[model samples]
Target: MTTFYTVIDWLMVFGYWLLIAGVTLRILMKRRAVPSSMAWLLVIYILPLVGIVAYLSFGELHLGRRRAERAKAMWPSTASRLNKLKESRRIFATEYSPVARPLFQLCDRRQGIDGVKGNQLQLFTTTDETLKALIRDIGLARHNIDMVFYIWQPGGLIDQVAESLMAAARRGVHCRLMLDSAGSLQFFRSSYPSMMRRAGIKVVEALKVNLLRVFLRRMDLRQHRKVVLVDNYIAYTGSMNMVDPRYFKQDAGVGQWIDLMARMEGPVATTIGIVYACDWEIETGKRIFPPPPDVNIMPCEQESGHTIQVIASGPGFPEELIHQALLTAVYSAREQLIMSTPYFVPSDDLLHAICTAALRGVKVSIIVPRGNDSTMVRWASRAFFSELLEAGVNIYQFTGGLLHTKSVLVDGQLSLIGTVNLDMRSLWLNFEITLVIDDDGFGSDLACVQEDYIARSTLLNAKEWQKRPFWHRLLERLFYFFSPFL
Candidate 1:
């Protein structure tokens, strides 16, 4: 009996190795980032069964058959809109700088959105300021209002926006509200959706969390976009959710979170409407009836603003458009670069580009929070600081509050703001939106906001870093191993 049991155990071990080899083969066929692929292989090799379970939960981006069909059905309408815009656009090649033109052109090809004229950009730095702006504009909403957000916790700023939305719905505004089930759990479980429904506001929860919804897609995929469109003429997009930043965490040394938003009044508002409509359609599996007031409903504002393109990205795309755009923009940068993001786990290509740029005489500075809520993220980010410091890249830790803004400004001639974070999940999993603007005036305004953030930041020098406890630094390096997926 012992001999028979030994033989059986050996057979099981052989089968497990065989299964791992098969999984590794499958991962290689997808051609993911080298580090990511290697990380999976390492995990699988260490504990085959447990690793397989982990991979099943996190590795796949498959959205299943029904969702795949729904997403496919969305494209024809999207293509139709793109074609219509192409035929009707007023071309002004000279409006964009030569350096910025190719990047925009690349995004135009990959993203459904295109450059639209007559759009003015307003940069808001403070949480109160943005919430006030949303309330003011929402109050002015006449024909309709549409808002899609990831997190909508019920509290100070969040409740105020909800009240405004409900008021608009009561006033007969065609108000539509969409929230992500995973991110907005607090509000989703609250009576807000019911209250809005009572007030005649349409509500849809994207990626509903349930066993049935799990079968809809790899459960990790989320809708992380924040967009607000009022009457098809004005829009707001950025990192701020309809929640109080202070509630992001409790007992963290950081008192409150700081974020940024962009207010746009232009044809780009129509573009934002299109993006929201797509999300709404996918979640409900129904067309946006009445077809969303035509893009030309308002008189063409020949001079209301400049040209800007709204870029949307997600797992559905053939490639990572946001990541590509950022990489391309960073490569094209010549003089100085400034960035701010809460998360710091960047892809290998992006991190190298940043370090290289600093080496090549470009001033590269990035501001992140001194103490993030996630201990793993904080440690991993600090692990990266040594390399950044060695390359002469100035690293600033925001001391005032949690720096939740995600932005990239190249040479102070371009500005990008939206829901994207400098992390793998934002690059690969979430549905995100960002506006790429090349207007110098708007870029200058964005730079000023960044300047205020820099003022409240503490620069970490190499000497100070080297004096940290050895165990802390070791843990930082160890935590960095998970950065490929973090």
Candidate 2:
């Protein structure tokens, strides 16, 4: 019996390898990047069972061929809008803000966000303020309200927003909501979607999860966009999720849920609305393409001297706009670079950029949460910090609360505020959006925010970090070893 059991186990191992080899051969034949394919191959070859699990989790691209075809078909329309925005900016060159020029060009060349004039942008600093503004915008919508969020839960502030959305739906306002199936599973499984649907709101789940679907598609790539576009004129995008307590916390009221949200009106809003429409069409198979030509393009009351461009990223898009945009902005920084993110995992390229910048005399500072929610990620992040500190990059850990803001202030001239975090998943895996603003005033405001965080946070000096216990360092090393998956 023992001999028979051993033979069966060996046969199972052989079957697994055979499966992995077949998939790898197919992927290679499809001409996927050699490095990526090789990496996957290595995982499967070395740790057969675990590699199969990891590959199933994060290997195959999630979007099916049909969805890819749809995105390709829609590319022309997106490109046309981008070209129009580019031409409009050129025609109004003198009217365009100088601070916004680099960002506009960066967006056009990188992320495809057109710089539209006469748009107002308001920055909200807290979740309460963000929710209040979001609810107000939803309530005031005249034509349509489109929202796409990673997490949309019921009860508390989110429930209030849901009620308002339902109310708007009943009033004949076209209300459509899209939530990531994976991120909002708990909410959807609860009474949220049914409750909203009964109130006349249309809700679609992006990427439903099933065992077979899990085998065929990657579950790690998520639609992590938090956007609310109303009436094709006003839009909201940022790090804030539509949930009570902002995010899941055990204490429920342990810390202030800090976030940064931006309200925009102009061509940018239309751009945001288009993003929502594209996602909606993809998920619901209902086309709401070609927004109305008469959508308002009014100039906003200016509060900052910076020019702003909105950059959107997703699996449907080939270019990694947010990541490239950050690299470009950081490389362009002359004096100082300050960034704050809830998650601080960095890609090798980003890590190089920061280290190189700091070494070159650019004062680079990064503020991250002291106690991150993920144990592995926190340990992995710490593993990278020592090198950065050694390279002269200043590190601060926010102590007051969960620092859930993705913001960067560069040289007091360029400011980037949005939903993308400084991590591998955000940069390469998940869909994200960010606003790159070219304004002295916006930079100044961001600088003030950074300074305030620094004042409250504890700086991680190199010596202090080096003095941590051996067990902690070993844990960090263990976490770092598996960071490629993390």
Candidate 3:
């Protein structure tokens, strides 16, 4: 009995030393933000074994060598082949408006394009309409159809898309489907990929997570982009996944999700296609050249002049430029800034920019779901609401449904739309695409959508929030401590 007691005591002492050595190595070898490093250390101090295991599994980003190599390989081709676009001098003739210039210039410097001119965007507010438009475009494919969806669950409107892809493939219009391995796991295990394969549609699953893969890559890192291009003329983006939102989070009790998608034409369509091509190349190591010169490029209308630029960010990029871009947009806003997203765990930089925007009288309003799919994320976001509300940013809780639209409107003139949620997963862990548009006409159209959402949302009362139960505040802050990882 005495020997057993001594052995256990020694084991505890050994584990304590081990924890210290591991943390020392992590601090010296791993390059992480100070807050993140401190957060991990705190976890280690509180729950030694659990924290070490968690840090080992989730700490270092290892999305595999192919992920790093794919970005390196694709950029040169992107630079040389697609960079030669002869953007018309009409838009550039007049300097970007003061409100938009900083944001546009930031984007232009980070991504290699000023907004592609002569573009048109058709916005869809519901899942049924978005899928209808997507199926319609897939049906019209002549040259090829390219699709990359993070979540491709098999049901609802997914069959329509599947049928369209199979039909397009059968008719010799090439079809390529790429779905994230984790997000689309059940789809891969189901008959969807097999059916598409049998029908001649090339299918690739991005970043499969497995026991062996845990060491080879960051298991949670995802490709959360949703893209579809038909021939070389039309493209679609924004928050709508292929599945119907009515069933998207049905189990979460959030009724039909309110989402938005933008169907694009003209040069922007080709730009979207090129962006898709980069992802396809990354996943399959096959290059998709800018189409044969014989294929016609859709030109925007002569009278209407709108422009869009595609910004894709993920583990592949050298830096998280998407985070900086959002910050720039917020900081550049002068009049009104209305933003909507499902999840809202923002980084320090984003949080500061938003608070500063509101404090400086930008009339900042952020609309989010009253209830969300993830309880953890909801709690973390709740902690920030108090700070933001105190800083003058109006927090609107949507009573209508889960607001899944991720868009930023600056001075009621520029609109940004895509898969990026205002959260850490979007900023660091997932591959995301955001479309930046500089046009008042389109902004007004998008504003009507935002206005409709605002009508359905309730402005949060700051004093009421402050009066919430002590337990509620404690739970929210506890979850918020994990925001960097969330």
Best by lDDT: 3
| Reference-based TM-score, model 2 | 0.89
Query: For each candidate, what is the lDDT?
Result: 0.82, 0.76, 0.82
Candidate 2: list runs displaced more than 4 Å: 1-42, 83-103, 111-113, 251-256, 290-296, 299-306
What's model 1's lDDT at 475? 94
Give Cα distance to truth, residue 322, candidate 3, Å.
0.7
Model 1 score (lDDT)? 0.82
User: Residues 323-442, candidate 2, lDDT per residue (tens digit)?
Assistant: 777888778777899999988878777889999999999999999988776788889898899899989999999988878889998888778888898877788777788877766766
| Winner by TM-score between candidate 3 and candidate 2 | 3
Query: Model 3: which ten-residue window has the lowest total lDDT?
Result: 292-301
lDDT of 3 by residue, 1-486 (tens): 999999999999998898778765876577766778889888877887788777777787776798678878788878765555534343231356677787778777877667666666789998888888788888888888888899888787878878988999999998888999889887888988888899999999987778776767788888899998887778888997778675566788877788899998766776677778788787788898756222234333432477677888886563778888898889889889999999999988899999999999889999999989889999999989988998999999998888999999988888899999999889877889999888898899989999999999999998898899999999998999999889
Tens-place lDDT per residue, model 1, 288-345, is 7323334454355554356687888875554688888888888878998999999999
lDDT of model 1, residue 27: 88
Find the 10 residues in a row with the least total lDDT in model 1: 289-298
Which residue pairs clash in candidate 2?
Answer: 306-438, 306-439, 307-438
